[model samples]
Target: MKNMNIQVKGTIAPGYGVASGKGGDSRFPQGTIEMQKPFFQELGLDLSPYFSGTLNISIHPHRYRVKSFKYTFINVKWSSIQPAEDFSFADCRILFNDSSFEGLIYYPHPDTKPDHFQAADILEVIAPKIDGLKYGDELILECDRTQIDIVIVKKFWKY
Candidate 1:
């Protein structure tokens, strides 16, 4: 078999704070504190992409250890990812079946510990048309892990 061991690089946290706040996280690299709307706009806002799909949140542990979690997209399909007119994009999602993680990215945290995104990271996503989506977008993904057993300890990127 090939190398099943991999390292996680970065992550997209869901609930981030800007100085003072309870919830709201930027899908971009941490320390890049931002508001969702403007952030999405920068990525060419189009909520339609999340109609029925997955948005992957990858983790690169900077080379550490940890488990992961994820949301599954059951009824999603490439064709259903609507608004296929001006710009076509892709959807990505990731999850680790047995782990929880936290750490700093981009800008180091006071704790500055390289955690999360371990060798056991999970990834699943649809291909973007082109340009590799160098920006961000608002997306919602649905997942269900009620009928499967995944004991993974490595990173996997599925394009």
Candidate 2:
């Protein structure tokens, strides 16, 4: 069966500085994505067109689980000081103010990820540089249902 398209509203949120290396994260002085590019390129995935940093999008009340993936690189020893980690990507689109940009959902498996864990509501996106985009900006995120399953988490109130 063909994949279904799912659209959810999300807000851009600040992320851990390790992805861009702007923050003083000693583990990734050059940024995690920047250091991993060469390894990804060697694995036949060139991330040159996209920005080195990730866009942290928050979809509150909703969380996602990977049903499948478009690309998955296993045990990539990108950093000399850190152990190898696995990464996955899925086709995605970011829509804002009548403009839509193609991107990939960047998923670095937490099992192998050493530090900087993200909340379930945050979706890390890797796309070409987006101008005039800032934190707290509302955006529409589109993904394939077959590749990602978005679900709502109900809250319980204490009596």
Candidate 3:
């Protein structure tokens, strides 16, 4: 695949924190994990290699669109715990504070996601927990340009 690096700045924000939940007790993290299990397995990935929850980052001014040559949508089935949903992801490397981690930029289908998660400037990233990070802190996100398309909707805005 063609490779290029794209960088952007974002600030930490509070999220549903459902990925930190165990099993099907919680809605998002648990449900996402269960739903994505089959898809990952099909790709020869381990059943559960990601953190249970996600980190919310508000990317100011600019919004990103991902276009991958080899991309697929993940369909999450409805169960006793939650409703069915569809989402897409792009692999990325996140740089926060002084640490970096490999992660995925998760974009839930607009119609399928909760209202709170529909912000255009917000990004949901799944990665191992980063210590000493808290809400309102700024960080940098670098990803493969081939996998993501960025469009600056507004020139300046504060969060």
Find the candidate with the highest TM-score and give its number.
Answer: 2
lDDT of 1 by residue, 29-128 (tens): 2222222223334554433322222223343332222232222222222222221112122222222333322211111121322222212332323222
Each candidate structure's TM-score, on Cα atoms with residue i matched to residue i, is: 0.19, 0.94, 0.75
TM-score of 3: 0.75
Ranking by lDDT: 2, 3, 1
In model 3, which regions exceed 4 Å deviation? 1-3, 22-39, 42-47, 69-71, 114-116, 155-159
Report, for every candidate in turn, its global Cα lDDT versus the true structure. 0.27, 0.91, 0.69
Give the runs in model 2 whose Cα sits over 4 Å from its true position: 1-3, 157-159
RMSD of each: 16.7, 1.9, 4.4
Candidate 2 shows a clash count of 0
Candidate 2: pairs in clash: none
Give me the overall lDDT of model 2.
0.91
Clashes of each: 20, 0, 2
C-alpha displacement of 112 in model 3, angstroms? Answer: 3.1
Model 2 TM-score is 0.94
